[model samples]
Target: MLSDFLALFFPRFCAACEGALAKGEKVICLQCDYKMAKAGGLTDNNNFVAKKFFGRVHLQYAWAYYLFNKRGRIQRLVHRMKYDQMPEIGEFVGHKLGAALLRQGLQHEFDVVIPIPLHKSKLKKRGYNQSEYFGSGISKALEVPLDAGAVVRTVNTASQTKKSRLARWKNVDSIFDVKDMAHVRDKHILLVDDVITTGSTIEACALSLQHAGAASVSVAAMAAAK
Candidate 1:
């Protein structure tokens, strides 16, 4: 009752819409959730995301939960997770992603889930890795272990948002390094991130995992920018 009383004045807002959240609404409002979740996404094995890496890296499967549009619900949700100190948004996204795969009977296709790591400095500043929370939710719901150290971000690159497609590739090309080869080798790995834009970061990580003898690497994220 005390929490409810406090909520009366300090009302919670939806992470995606910034509208007042009703009772029982956790991160996003119901309307916004439905809008974002209705997207076709990368349900099929051959998808937009998978095509992005056709010549760059070999991916067994690649899919995202939603499309990332500027100023859209997905953008807002990702912004909140990355900048507004609302990391739980990642977990919510992961739950949805896992449920989607489960519905398609693709949840058990991977042996382990690993989030794209952040550099130590950035992680210290952010207090968490947004992708890690997403991975946590997927692992819990999919009954797969989340290996946080499967790959490490060795170089702290600048933001890829303003860079050109080629520039983005150059920025993140060699940023990831495989930290634990034992966990990656002979395993079907799911490499996750918060968003997929130019696909450079994901490609780089997939290549690193493949080079490390991972049987196959699958890509997953909350949103994929068309």
Candidate 2:
């Protein structure tokens, strides 16, 4: 009972709600997890996430696990995951996404899972890529290989926050480069990321993968802004 004694003194809090985590709970409490808004129609070919890239990129599938509301629990969870050095939060959410997709029989649709890469500078600063952790969880659930080194972010563009849609697209356009075509060539790729706003970053990454000869590219994210 030493673990229980330690927990009594140093209780772990839920990442989303900051409530004392109950036994068997990790990262997020069950109540908060249940309350988080889920993106609907994930199995549809023309789902919301897929529609975001219409006329820009051809995605084999596209889905997001949650609807991101400003100041919501998802926002807090993502903030802590990205800025608070808690990458486990991403993996937790991603595993849920992978489980959902697995239930829909979509696990085998992708040959590899590629998290959108961060620039070297940001990677060094963050010490971990949140998306890669997300991809890791998905890989574990879906039984797909996770490849973080196949692609690289060539430019460390400024944050997309507060930027107009057009500006956001321009900022991320052509910023991704495929380092090893063998990993992606003629393979169905599932691109994973934390969030999607204007969809510019995902579009850019998909385009890069397509140019590198990926047979098809799909997208998955932890959340998408409404």
Candidate 3:
């Protein structure tokens, strides 16, 4: 077949392992996908992810897809998505996340998917919000609408990449503002993000939505530091 001929000439490598993908393999090879970490039981409302926000926010449900280890395979994939100018990576991973959540019966739980916002300046430079791609993937799989602009970053704080957990929390207060309440007021929103480091960013946005009268809020991310 023409596809087989093309495959022989130009085999694609897995994003995580750099191993040549066999038939049916996409961004990540089957072997890598099998070995990649998971965030664990998705149904527990009081899971590890929920514990992160204890005393800070009341999450309806909260979890991540994978464990984030420094310089690991997951980290490599994330770096490509965040800095290697590979936007499609976000779309693909998000789709996978959405599909998993859907299989777990979370499809009907949220009315809308909202990405944590980026300031206009950063969005312009990045050309897209990574979290929006995640939300879009969730929207497509779960058949829910994506409200990409529900929140706005009023202040462009310094990157939390190098900051300590306490410092990250200190840098994020009052940085997010909900753009409008019409859609969020009575909806249960699923807040999506790329990776959760200090949990400050997602916490801030979740509180903003709750304060604005969202019926409830849940959180999802591609990965989280262990």
List CA RMSD, all candidates.
3.5, 3.5, 3.9
lDDT tens per residue, model 2, 1-226:
3224434554489989999989898778999989989887676888888898899989988989989888889999899989987787788888889988899998788899999999999999999999998998888889999999999999998676788878778778779999999999999999999998778899999999999999999999999986
Question: Order of all candidates by lDDT, from best down to worst?
Answer: 2, 1, 3
Model 2 poorest 10 in a row by lDDT: 1-10
Q: For model 3, what is the alpha-carbon lDDT of residue 198?
A: 72
lDDT of 3 by residue, 72-153 (tens): 7999988877776665656677788889888998789899999988888988898888788767877888999999877899
Compared with the true structure, the alpha-carbon lDDT of candidate 3 equals 0.82
lDDT of each: 0.83, 0.88, 0.82
| Model 2 residue pairs with clashes | none
Per-candidate clashes, comma-separated: 0, 0, 0
Write the number of the candidate with greater TM-score, choosing between 1 and 2: 2
Q: Which sections of candidate 2 miss by over 4 Å?
A: 1-11, 159-164
1-226 per-residue lDDT for model 1 (tens digits): 3224434554488888889988788677888888774336555666777877888988888888887888777887888889977777788779878877787787678899999999999999999999998888788778889999878998887566777878778768789889899999999998999888778888888888988999999988888887
Better of 2 and 3 by lDDT: 2
Candidates ranked, most accurate by TM-score first: 2, 3, 1
